[model samples]
Target: MKRRTFDKLVSFVGLGLAALLLIFAGLLNFGANFANDSVASQLENQNISFPAEDAMPSETKDQLAKWAGMKVVTGEMARDYSDLYIWEHMKGSAIAVMGKPATYSEVSGVYMGLVRGGSTDVEKIKQYGDLRQTLFMGNTLRGMLLEAYAFGTLGVIAGYAAIASLVGGVLFLLLGIAGLMHIRRTPEDATI
Candidate 1:
């Protein structure tokens, strides 16, 4: 094939590749931005705020204090609120009542066992009921926060991908331009 023609073909192919990569980068960037914004907005609407530094819970005092007085606005913040704040409080309450830090399933099973045994002590029934309710709410909140964390993580991954794609696009574009310049410098009668 003629050297010029071969170079032209390769240049066009490189340009096409650059265009495709750039388009992919743009789409990924949009997705990442959307995910980040959605997570922040949803958390903001909840109006959840971190503990005052001095009021940090005993077990998570140092970790929780990092975000003290800050409202939940990001997935990381949501995770901190759920795991450090809400989870600790729930566990503490359970320990106070049940004499142990137990999971929601554990509490539910015990409560159901008592009911099945036909226990009719009103105070005990109500105590279990209240504790179960609090745990249920805490678990639900934790699930939501974890979901936000997952989405935000995906967004972060997408952002990194977008950056890589952009770099690839730029590299391909430069290669394409260099190929075009090579074609210009090639002799018309050159064959390869």
Candidate 2:
């Protein structure tokens, strides 16, 4: 091929690579957004309440104070009183307080567990119930899997890796068309 043809090929390759990158970026963004939305939906659907009250059981306070500096709180002891659990419980309670129509399928089970545990005080029961994990079950894993699935599904539907892929394809197609027209108009330019 002549110099002009070679240059055109190089330009096309560059465009294609840039498009691929943009598409991937879009996929990442969409995945993150979808995962967040899913989490919010699950929280709402499961009726997991939050914790925001002056009343905290001694056990809960001890546990929470221990893990207050950490972002993630798991394991047996922390399960009862971590901020994560409190946040979930508070949200659920807030919904009830607001008189919103929501109910946990496991409400009875939760109450029974508290009763069996001999924690009649609402604050104490809320603190140690370990119900958050149950309400938003497998939340972390679900978020990751959801993101991957959403990105993959979008990739197939759009014929690109991400939402940005569409833009990439459009720009690529336009450039290709323009280049082809330029070449046809100056076929002799290739020889020069």
Candidate 3:
């Protein structure tokens, strides 16, 4: 094979790869921006205003009790209660009652049952409703915070990927240009 032709081929391939990388980087950046915007919009729409204290309004507590009373999990639902219960029964109230979000770690702890207190008797259910309210609020706050953090992390990763890809693309392009220059300086008939 001719040395000039080989260099030309390498140059073209490198340039092509660079172009592809740049395009990929652009797409990744676009996706990251879109995701960030979406998350921000969703958060704004939810209007979460976490409270300073772990207290729920009396009306909210009553509503929680009513919802709890209405819940009749059966079979698989009962088995999946942990997964479904908080999200289904408490998410809206918890978000509203919380008035603001908590950190992901705090919420995850609640979700994982790490934040739970000692078991209470059935007779003490009414008396401990306030405690339940506080727990619910914390759980809700944690869930939202965790979701936001996840979205933010995804955006950050995408941004990093985009930056890496852009750098790679630029390096590849420079190498391709250098190869083309080398080809130009070599004799056309030079054999490899």
lDDT of 1 by residue, 1-192 (tens): 999999999999999999999999999999999999999998889888886998878889888888989999888888888888899999998998799998889888888888888998878877887889999999999999989988988888899999999999999999999999898789999999
Model 1 worst lDDT window (10 residues): 121-130
lDDT of each residue in 47-156, candidate 3, tens digit only: 54322222333334433342343332222222222234434344444354344434334444544352265444543433235435566675665566556656766877
Q: Rate the local accuracy (lDDT) of all candidates.
A: 0.91, 0.50, 0.60
Tens digits of per-residue lDDT for model 2, 1-192: 675686578568756766776767676666655654554454345443323433444435554454443422112212333333444454555345334422344544555677797775987566334443343443453444344444444434444345556566667767766765565565554663
Worst 10 residues of 3 by lDDT: 72-81
The global Cα lDDT (0 to 1) of model 1 is: 0.91
| Poorest stretch of ten by lDDT in candidate 2 | 71-80
**What total of clashing residue pairs does each candidate reach?**
0, 12, 6
The TM-scores of all predictions, comma-separated, are 0.93, 0.34, 0.58
lDDT of 3 at 192: 88
> What ranges in model 3 sit over 4 Å off?
49-123
